[model samples]
Target: VQDPKHAKKTARNQLHSGARLLVLGNNVMLYRHLLTLAQAKNHAIYIRDVVNVDKQDDGAAYRLFHSDVLEQMYQNELENNEMQSLFVYLFVLGDLFDSYLNRNIFHKERIIMAMRGYFFLNMWAEYIES
Candidate 1:
């Protein structure tokens, strides 16, 4: 507790502040807005399922949740942000480039690097996977 250098090294080594998916206790967070949205769409999107890997296997493997679930979560988070700038990186903006609406606009050539956004995505995966 008294060692600053060791504390700094530990901080650097840590995976950092985290989000929880409490499968062991079956306590998961369902956002209220997402619940409303799912109800409106007439679909309940459950994130996890128990599936047996093989007939010989004694137990089930918990497959990762569908990409759509993560995408929905990402989209919801991005939408909730005050700036909404994350969409340009998260969602494929390729369609916007082909639209006639964008025909007259000047687009920058590689104005931003995608690695930063990807780093966040990888970091989130670490939170989920680890």
Candidate 2:
């Protein structure tokens, strides 16, 4: 099947009479669905750990409780949990990081530029695919 000729011959056999253009199959949703599910599961575990930790160091506990990202996670509405929706949020996050790095990258050139490039490429790929 790796050979184009072999593939063509197989397809030609199937199409001989009135074979419908049937898509055999593809797990297009598998990765996207699993990634979204993992994110949700991780968030749940984080919340449980945060809640169950013995209240010893009030400062550390307070910091975890007051984390802005946690607040955003709670308040943000997840769109349909589709692949497109997941990446949209990721790129937006990456863009925010990129913007923050933009100002300081020139001063710290090498290190900052590397991080910036990562985010920029992430967003760029998402943009191109979408």
Candidate 3:
């Protein structure tokens, strides 16, 4: 378990050290449970929502996992992958590139897109959401 006071720093260090997968606990107890797991395994951990940072690297590989967000991404990726036709593949790739470009430039659009693309978009959203 993590003390709320230290959650932000713990999360930052974990993220900086290449912790790629994240499971968020919306409440203090859950957060602490996750913290304990991370500590037990000697892995760095971060608490979402409570942590504040000025900026984050655009290319960080970390992914925050939550139920609903995972489902959407899974569905989208599956839908994209299951279309056996080349035309569908091209269209998906084109959409992907376009989304990337829009996200790179437009703050609001990026948040909407990232929210659709991954869980915990807020971690990075703060940078662009401004």
Kindly report which residue pairs in candidate 2 clash with one another: none
TM-score of 2: 0.21
**Model 3, range 14-108, lDDT digits (tens) per residue?**
43333343322221112233333233322322333214423342221122222222333344432543222222222332233334554355766
Predict model 2's lDDT versus the native: 0.37
lDDT for each residue of candidate 2 in 20-111, tens digit (9 for 90 to 100) = 33221221222223223335634422332233343343333223223243433444424443344323333443333343434644545545
lDDT tens digits by residue: candidate 1, 1-130 = 3442332223212211134322211223233433333443332242212121132221111111223433554655445642133233213222221221234444442323234434554665576677
> In model 3, which regions exceed 4 Å deviation?
1-99, 103-105, 120-130
Model 3 clash pairs are 1-32, 1-36, 11-46
Question: Judged by lDDT against the true structure, how good is candidate 1?
Answer: 0.31
Q: Using TM-score, rank the candidates from best to worst.
A: 1, 2, 3
- For model 3, the run of ten residues with the poorest summed lDDT: 57-66
**Between candidates 2 and 3, which one is better according to lDDT?**
2
**Each prediction's whole-model lDDT (CA):** 0.31, 0.37, 0.33
Candidates by lDDT, descending order:
2, 3, 1
